[model samples]
Target: MLDFLKPPVLTIQEFFILAGRTIRSIPRRPHYLNDLLMQMDIIGVGSLPIVLLTGFFSGVVMGLQMSRALQTYGAVSQTGPIVAITLVREMGPVLTAVAAAGRNSSGIASELGSMKVTEQIDAMRALGTDPILKLVKPRFLATSFMLPCLTAIADFVGMIGGYIIAIGLLHLTSAEYWNGAYRALEYDDLAQGLIKPFIFGMVVSLVGCFYGLRTTGGTQGVGRATTQAVVVAIVWIFALNALITKIFVSR
Candidate 1:
């Protein structure tokens, strides 16, 4: 009872202590870098197909909707640029992060939870291996590297989708669509979109690893941890996206 009433300050202190321990573990097991690179391939490269497909469809839908809405204003030609701007400045990074949170975060939590349940993490500790360096670091590094790349790919594919729909379905000239897209797609827009994914990646990986590390009570606890990791990662990612967008757009 009294324990439950402990000051919230202790929570912050505990977080810092855990973070320090995690950071300190990084230098002791350098091979985690190699494992991290492999995970990047799995999470980033392998995710490309789905990202591309989704981006393409999203762009097509945007173009179609915008075309219909703007035809009354005789501004149908603006569809391509609008689609490009939206994809590069918002949708690409946001969608990619959501997908990654669902896929990678869940997988990381489940895998690590299973390891914890099986006492494999304990075994590793007994073998003098730091789990944070060997497990958490690799995932953190992989997610950080892969997220930006995925966002970039999604942006590109989404633009292409807009192009196809604009030119083919809307009866707009390909040259006109391309021209508007090229003119409107500013470097700042791309940079703004790209920046958010790195933060999202970090959040996803950290939350997943944190929940997994804290897993207990055998199988049921592991399952709960995995579920919680996914839920928290998704909520944080969306909230962060909104905050970032407010910062950029409000400015």
Candidate 2:
């Protein structure tokens, strides 16, 4: 009983420790510029299609629902602004994080888990190289930097998607829809949208790294860690989303 209780506490401690180490190393020498850029490409470019698709569909559906609701009130034009604000403030960042958690988080965990089981990480240690510095930090920084970019893309794409529905299907005028959407957005909403994804990105990357580094039992352990990483990343994203939302919105 005591031992089982320890894993959760230990995991939390180690995860924070790894996060601290990652943060401290950011300004140090031998910066892995190439690796960081490569990870940015992989996490950013590689994840773009999914982010765009998620945003597009979400916006379209939101516009559809809002159109029906607003039409009864003779406010069909407001669909654009409503959809835009919701996407900009919530859906864009949260959905993108979820998708990335499902895709990239698992990929990172599985890759690192495989390395752990194969003793490749051990080889790095033997060579006097810090795996955390080379591997974890790059992924961590890449995800952190790329998520806002991805959220921006998702927000833009979501607005376009909403525009298509609002202008095309709902028969709302393009000018009215766009103007309303533009007017409805507050700088705070944009700020929150950007901030949420950056925070979620760290959650995804660090959780994956922590679980991956702790993998055991060969291939099975890798699979387990990958699954755990995705699940945990998603849970943390939602939990953090709520907390951050309250903090920002309340102020």
Identify the leading candidate in terms of TM-score: 2
- Model 1 global lDDT (CA atoms, 0 to 1): 0.83
Writing each residue's lDDT as its tens digit, candidate 1 over 1-251 gives 67865654674465456556666766664576578788888788877887888888888888888988988899989987899899988889888888888888888888898898899999999998878888888888788789989998888888888888888878889888889988998878877888899888887887788778778888899889889888888888889988988888887
Number of clashing residue pairs in every model?
Answer: 0, 0
Model 2, range 86-149, lDDT digits (tens) per residue?
9989999999999999988999999999999999999989998899888999999999999999
In model 2, the runs with Cα more than 4 Å from the true position are 1-4
- Candidate 1 pairs with clashing backbones: none
Each model's TM-score? 0.89, 0.97
Flag regions of model 1 displaced more than 4 Å.
1-31
Candidate 2 vs. true structure, TM-score: 0.97
